[model samples]
Target: MQSLGPLRPRSTVLVKRPWLTKPFNWRALSSIPPSDYSNQSRGGLPRFFSETLPSSKGGVIRVQGDEFWHMTKVLRLKTDDRVELFNGKGGLVEGFIQNIDRSSIDFVALEDPKLVLPQTPQWHIFAAFGSLKGGRADWLVEKCTELGASSVTPLLTQRSSTISDNRVERLQRVILAAAKQCQRLHEMKLNHPMKIDNLIPLVAKSKQSFIAIAEGTPLVSALTSTTKESSGLIIVGPEGDFTEKEVDLITEAGATAVGLGPHRLRVETATIAILATLTLWSGSQQISNC
Candidate 1:
């Protein structure tokens, strides 16, 4: 391995944040990606997402297409601008604009890019927000990504409204933007829309699983015994909530039903609440996954 010099602090950390508006070329979102929809820029350096990075130290990594536009136009970066780059899979490197143009930017890796694998025991959230009114579903994904969830899968139950592929692609952009903002190493993954029946095997594969239900065990109390770092799954129902048979099916597949509170919560609200509570519980148990 080649020895590397210490990272240089950016002389000026641009205050301008990347424009993350959705539907900005939906095709670009489908083409590109982000962290749990989040990441925190280190050393005050601006961060951007790339699909791939160079294999060896001092390699050349190219930024083009929407990514190129974001850097050149949105961020208005110039040659020699010190910046950080990350691939969604935990690869990160500090490099400078070795060259630039209207079409693309080329970065010269200062040090070999390093890949940090995501920790074990990822917590995957399955939510039925297909029918959420307005942008609540989008908001739920944004916040969840910022919180560093392992993955979010749109759940389909008896009450779930049908979701289109285009919508999923739209959510992908939200995920990308959030991951970049939080400076998360591993991009929080966004799974495809899944039917309740399809989730049965996944539930069993998890070391632990929880389903949110109105008269069930308290959320915190439900996670009390199993916080030592192991993979798990959590499910949230759609508008009318899961039917008794549906809940029973998941429960029989080794999922425990946990209660949020007496008041009924919106689909998005319930999903975020459960995710946030789990994040806190994991922190207390020395297993903060976020």
Candidate 2:
């Protein structure tokens, strides 16, 4: 038998590198676009979402799936294209595309992200989903994301229809797209559906809780009377509205009944009304403080 010397590992050769040749440049990454979106952010640069992101610079961030498709195929982004990335948790960063493949985009973040502090008294909505038909729920989710609500949860009630996990997932997709469109540093949340019984306990423990009903305190007035620093929970039912027993459970848990107006509103309309009112109210409150 022939004696062989200790085997050495084979060296691998590279033809083309997928990553950017030049080092990451914060300035280039952040270079401003034309004055089209003068009010805020880079106009030329598009935004994408990665569920979580690196806190500081030089970390490789990979974006995949739907976000990746939008970046490459849909948006036709090329290597070295500047773009903004945000995590749903109040994190926003500017970076340039360093590499791209069939399924993912790799980029490096080299600067501290601009952090957006949550609005004072962040508001959340717990709405009944069973009766929302013909894409009403999707519209609600999209609009809520744009309007800057903290989170939205579907509620189970006697008169409401049952929502599937698949439907909730669909709403989540809407949230992402809308967040990107509105340039939110923090994406609006879409929570798993909860039963009115389960919600009653949460409502009981909440400092500010309100319910929409036929006769009660005016919506705006109710919000105005609350302290500025209190986070709120707003509950709205489906088209059929909450059953007598469901209302009893919710209200007994310390939810203040609030009326929208003379006219009755659908689940989607009423929920939007509450959120829109809250948005305008929050802005005015900030101005007053300033």
Candidate 3:
């Protein structure tokens, strides 16, 4: 049997060559390596797939685009290579690299994954915050994923400086990578950017909503006083804060005004705090299910 030593972190390209190749009885393989898989630092989606080997098996999920590039180029993975696959389904699936070429690679799923979906009451953390300056919006999206935000909506407010350039493809990668690392099976819903005027109409459609004001009502008190039977929404303003008219419009639309803390936080900070609190609350309710 031939061996391929532990992967070099700095290796640039993995090419196919007889001398560089190793042999293994893929059919005899029993499990995935512990060193190659991790479920920490994952966020955004409850479930996602990285371009690497399958962690385990079941019905396969969709993973297209750049992920296909990683499989074909970076990994230098070839057909029949034994690999690992995970789906955040509470189990791992052992698979074989059945198809591999310059264009794509498909793993034949073999076993069940280990991570299962949460069965608790769903918490819909919807945010309507002003877009940030330069690349700050990207940073917000990445961190928000880790904080367990289910969806994020960029809001255009009077105080916001400029609208962000649409880079949907790049942003989606950040979310996908986070989800794979955390073993989350679901994806974060990212809504298109819209003005506060358009957002007001949707607020009335929700049964529960909260707007995080820097100084209005305390976060805990506001949340505890509300009914927990339905999913909720939270709106955060830009660094300069929401305009008086905007706040009143949202309030009249049924959004409860709430505060995050005493000190004022940046747009991203406030958004993450809201998501973290909601995620914790949702996770606690599902303790018995986990």
Q: Each model's C-alpha lDDT?
A: 0.71, 0.70, 0.56
Which regions of candidate 1 are displaced past 4 Å?
A: 1-41, 225-229, 284-290
Model 2, residue 225: distance off in Å is 4.5
TM-score between candidate 3 and the true structure: 0.66
lDDT of 3 by residue, 1-290 (tens): 01112111121223233222333233433533322233322322122254332323433333345655666576656677665554332244556666665555555556644334433333344344444556666777776655555566667778774344446555666766665554444455566666778777778887777788876788778767766632567688877788889889999999888887789898877877776676565444321111
Q: Per-residue lDDT for 1-290 in model 1, tens only? A: 11112112112112112222222231221121233222333347888887665544466766777667778898888999988888777677778898886577887767656665464336788999988777887899988887667788888888887677777777887877777777766767777678889899888776778899997898877777655444578799987889999999999998989988889988888888987777666653322233
Better of 2 and 3 by TM-score: 2
Worst 10 residues of 3 by lDDT: 1-10
Ranked candidates (TM-score, high to low):
1, 2, 3
The local lDDT score (0 to 100) that residue 198 gets in candidate 3 is 74
- Where does candidate 3 stray beyond 4 Å? 1-65, 72-94, 111-131, 161-166, 283-290
Model 2 TM: 0.79
RMSD (CA, Å), candidate 1 to true, equals 11.0
Q: Local error of candidate 1 at 250, Å?
A: 0.7
